[model samples]
Target: MPARDGDEPSFAVAADRSQWRYRPRRAFWRSRIVRAVALVTLLALCALVILALVREQTGTEGFLVGLGLAVLPVPLLMAAFRWLDRVEPGPWKNLLFAFAWGAFAAALVAILANSFAVRWIATATADPGSADDLGATVIAPVVEETAKAAAVLLLFLFRRRDFRSLVDGVVIAGFTATGFAFTENILYLGNAFGEDQDLGDGGIGAVTAGTFFVRVVMSPFAHPLFTVLTGIGFGLAALAPRGKRLRRVLLPVAGLLLSMGVHALWNGSATFGGPLAFYAVYAMFMVPAFGLLTWLAVWSRQRELRTIAGVLPAYAAAGWLSPEEPLALSSMRARRTARAVASRTYGKAGARAVGEYESFATTLAFLRERARRGTVPVPDFAAREQELLHHLWERRATASPALSYAARATGRVWVPPQYLDYGGYNPYKG
Candidate 1:
């Protein structure tokens, strides 16, 4: 064995295989830790919910009534949030946590703070009548919106990779806002029902029922829609060039003020004898505003899709991605089809890798844009960018075999003609 001069080294092959084994073991442990933390957090939130439901003397019937009212609108609202998030899907666990944080932690804190603030303000002003309005309109909107928005801000701080676009931020913020609204509605509904029970057979019950119907049906969008504006600001700020720190701060502040203004106006209009004024204001101002934002969101999403098409040719020529993959990536429908092909050819893991790679590419693009804008600090920018790229490369490497097989089975070899011109081709040339 020692006399073999041209033999390949066995130790090198063994080391390479060992490195591969080490990676999966590390990944397994990391996943286990993440799951453990997620489970613990969820259990704690559930315990809080149980405590909130049981602390009242209303017993099981009362709790059920309250829960019923609270849970009713959740599905519809969740669907709406999902629609908003269609542009860039995020982690479900993070979204759920954001909502729960608002429902439990934010709601509890806001109630306490708003109550204390109203009492202090009322005493100082020597006006008990003003205290009720203070809590409902001024203090409540400011404190509650801020609390709900904090959930999104914390997400950006902790999980930047998960939030690839403004839509992701909006959806996450909307979820938090919805959670706050749901819990608040429950309290209002329960109080109304309880008050009705005390008043006699028909009177209080009818009024409470009417209130619940209006809050649940007509104005379910109130809190979430309002807070989504702030989410837009926060999300945009997060994307701003690191150099424009002032803009980041000011933009979100402006958004918060806008949210407060809308909330205050809504509260003010509700105090009127007729809902006509509220309807009129909503028609004249709020509807138009929301429509404009929706249009902007769609336009922005289209631009992002175009960006992938523009940048991905380089990778296609490098053999990392097929030219056809970029086109498919631009369309959600096509992306789904690609995943189906992957799943059929390989398995769930192949499909999942496709999704992960797509997400990684989107995040990388956002980071690159941020870096170009000087929003990312120069010192750490290169390292972070490289890390993101490396992750994308690794994901592609894992999925390539499956994707190649899938492409062959489907009789579709997606070669990008434009890939030849990616590095240096003059568009002006014939």
Candidate 2:
């Protein structure tokens, strides 16, 4: 029999009821056990750190003071990097872990390896007394840069998509460098504190405070800024056309050379009485170079926005968006506005879905650009594009009901069935 007017189809109603009834629940005890294990592991690591620090030093006061001083500059430097990462921000947890790896794991390895290399080189050259200078100028730069840069390289290996541009690379690289600098500073500050203890408390406190001021305040950017240049090189290398393997290799090599040279110059100039020469070199060379590179990043991001805007017109015409909506989609402001509409209509869950859809769109744009430039293999590109499209559809479906309601209330339809079809939103028949 034919379905009656204003009456729901029996099969459609049954399917909707089944969907509502389908809820997958996990065993509560299993989840609790996993959380318990993770908590224990974290506690174990903390215990190990405390044990190691206690065994290595005579007094806790100097170490605590050093740790306090060392941690102060990290947040400020991280904020600066965050400002630079506006175009493509990384996952905060991943970024923080990278920083921790650089500060603790890399710092420990670098100090050991650098010390060993310096000793070996000095002995081989019959210049035992020159070990400290060699370590500072040559060994330290090579070891520390490699160690800190390793954090960024690891990020590339694991989370390649997070590294969309030079600024993204610089942010990760800077955080890693900041981590290394923090740990190293703690050691130096702790030693200074201990040394000061031999003198009167006033004298010790004054000297320690002065050293902290000069190191942490006057030149906090020294290490992170140096490493960020190399990161820019790595990011460019990652985005270079696939066939230009040699160019990719050369870019990072040149960047590393630039990093080492800057580091050596910084150390060399510090040996002099004043920073006049260092300041001149930085102002004349480093500042202009970094400034130009930063300008290029901003220009590239703007170009990306224009490219996305140009390409999206076809979808807009197909009813996926209004003509004006495409213009809005080209800006983060508009994206945020859309998210707000989703939230007000459907609550936080709908807002989250909207955000995910936006993220998927951004990823799709990046991948498409890479494919167009031949940076990604053409054969695999289609599959990746489809995967991103599927995710976009799922997120859009979650946000769609609210969006449709909003459109109706305002008498300004933004997305209709034709839009859904254009966006590949195929409903599950099962």
Candidate 3:
């Protein structure tokens, strides 16, 4: 049999296929290991630097107290960002990396760079007070924002697949800034605590309590709000077409500059207009800006959901998806209901499969839109479509019933006549 010429081709093909499978697995694992090791080493180095800096500035007791108190807002901020990202939900690893960069690497860079710049200015100017003012108004903002923006820039260049839209940038930036702020709060609060120790029972209310009240309670989101402007730049740059080279390049730069300007204004407020400056900026600028960004994020999410609802019907017509699927996947409430039902019936595995089904379905919808726009290559489109269809097929028996139930419970009909056209319900249209 081995000697036969015709059989040789088949034997060779089988061997090639077998070899290809193991090769990819081996390469994938090797690459993953290398990346993991590199990331760990980098984070470890940053942690050491940041730890030494903080612990040196704040004594052991103050550092401990700061560490205990500084952690209070971390979970709340994390949960808020997580909630915003519930629709697409970037992997936790990306967020963790972003936070680490902000807390350690970014903070370290900011401290060293800012301190060096201020010292240089002091030496040149012969007036330490004015040099300090210049650093706060000019140096701090530019240095700190650029430092925080490193996370966004890294993700934009390296993890392009995950940094999809403006929301992703905002979330990643927010987390990074949050981490930076956490470390910064620890330093400030701890320093204030040290100052309180020198009060000798003279002051009624300690600086530590006042500092915590101002930073942690009143303005916990200050750093995140500043960094998110830069993130928006990165996100929009990602969305820009290849043809718009200037847009892609300039958007991020503009965003970084804007973030720096805002940060500078915030830092210089005390010097520029005294104590009322903070209140004026907070009311006249910060609150309005935050509100606008929140609106934009929510609106953008709605637009994405609408894309799913509108685009997937074509696939349904082609019999690649259940008619109810697009409707179910479009509604976040329905998606949650679907997962709950799957979990209740078929256990955690079923719930996980349903979640995958939803994600794959959303990805498929976006892919189709991209394909129609000629943004994706034909072979890639076909390959991805086939892959997504296969997964949906595998889980359809379990996921379909759950999704159908979700559609029913959530009052999302799979029938025709969409209401997104006018932004109002059209119950009679179906």
Candidate 4:
């Protein structure tokens, strides 16, 4: 049946079941929950395998020591990324998957590939020294960056909606790199401990201390910094118009290449000019680059807020939202205040509903803006916008009052219209 005057538009085509040529033999496996469970199980298996391999190489005591030390920076890095994503946070499941993919699958691939390449170079060239140098400066960078990038690419491809913005790419990539760094640190620290034991040092050995200082204390952000370049590329690609396929493909490749070059340069610093070169690169290049990227990520986050504020007024004018909602939603402080007011008045459920409303509103703004720009396909945009609007409508009872109060409290100063009853006003219809 065709849509009626009061009905939302239907973008989906109706298909006849009798006309199907083929159907899945195992329909149960096609469910999203089933696919998710399978993916998680696979990642867990990879983690177990990698853990076993590392333990075998490092020994039990070394593995334990490495595990303890390597965990120090994980929480800090994860927290920093999570903080950056506060404006429009992606689902935690996506973050978790990225981390697991990095920690297990990507790390495992890097280890196997690097080790194989190094061994092959050693045998073919009859020079252990050359193999070690080549692996560090060439093979390791290419392999590890590519391996880590796989996770980012997978998320970008499979979770396109959640992976919409630059901040989303950065956060997802950061989590993946954090996991990769954590696993890599474990291996490096564990090996250093093993070497220390070989020297019969009863206490804290020089090798172990040096590795810990470098990997944990000094340059814990090293891996994440490298991968974030690739993420920036994907984020930019996500913003590209749908017709610009070449730009989309080239952006990510350019980012991956840049990541590989930087990784190689950092690795080769020690070989080029010894300790002075390494420190010089760290002080001059690494520190400044990290600072620049940090600024960019934060600026992008603020830009998202500005975008929301700019685009949402149209929806408000259309009666999809209260007049004061866009202003209140754009300010992070106001958003928080709104949630707090809901929590105080209606307890946890109200707070949760308010949070959902905020998310839906922000998402709707983004979708509509993209639609206007022709970046998102029309049908997909229509369906997603309608879905988000419906969600916002459902929670408006709890969310609107809180947001209106927030707007007034934050100085936006909305007065109730004399013609409409403020308490019972129906602000939206789907």
Residue 313 in model 2: lDDT: 59
Residue 381 displacement in candidate 4 (angstroms): 1.8
- The candidate with the higher lDDT, 1 or 3, is 3
**Alpha-carbon lDDT, every model:** 0.70, 0.69, 0.82, 0.88
| Candidate 3: tens digits of C-alpha lDDT, residues 360-419 | 888788777767655466776776666666566667778878998898788897445454
Model 1 alpha-carbon drift over 4 Å, by segment: 1-60, 124-126, 199-205, 272-274, 377-430
When 2 and 4 are scored with lDDT, the better candidate is 4
What TM-score fits each model? 0.76, 0.75, 0.88, 0.89
Instruction: Give the root-mean-square deviation of each candidate in angstroms.
Output: 8.4, 10.1, 7.6, 6.6
Segments of candidate 3 deviating more than 4 angstroms: 1-30, 201-205, 373-375, 414-430
Higher-TM-score candidate of 3 and 4: 4
- Give the range where candidate 4 is weakest over 10 consecutive residues by summed lDDT: 14-23
RMSD of 2: 10.1
lDDT of 2 at 268: 66
Candidate 1 C-alpha lDDT tens digits along 293-351? 76866776777777766665555665446656555565666566667867886689878
Candidate 1: TM-score? 0.76
TM-score of predicted structure 3:
0.88
- In model 2, residue pairs whose N, Cα or C atoms come closer than 3 Å (at least 3 residues apart or on different chains), thus clashing, are none
What is the lDDT for 9 in model 2? Answer: 21
Tell me how candidate 2 scores on lDDT: 0.69
Off by over 4 Å in 2: 1-59, 122-129, 202-204, 272-276, 282-304, 397-430
Position 31, candidate 1: lDDT:
82
Tell me the lDDT of model 4 at 208: 97
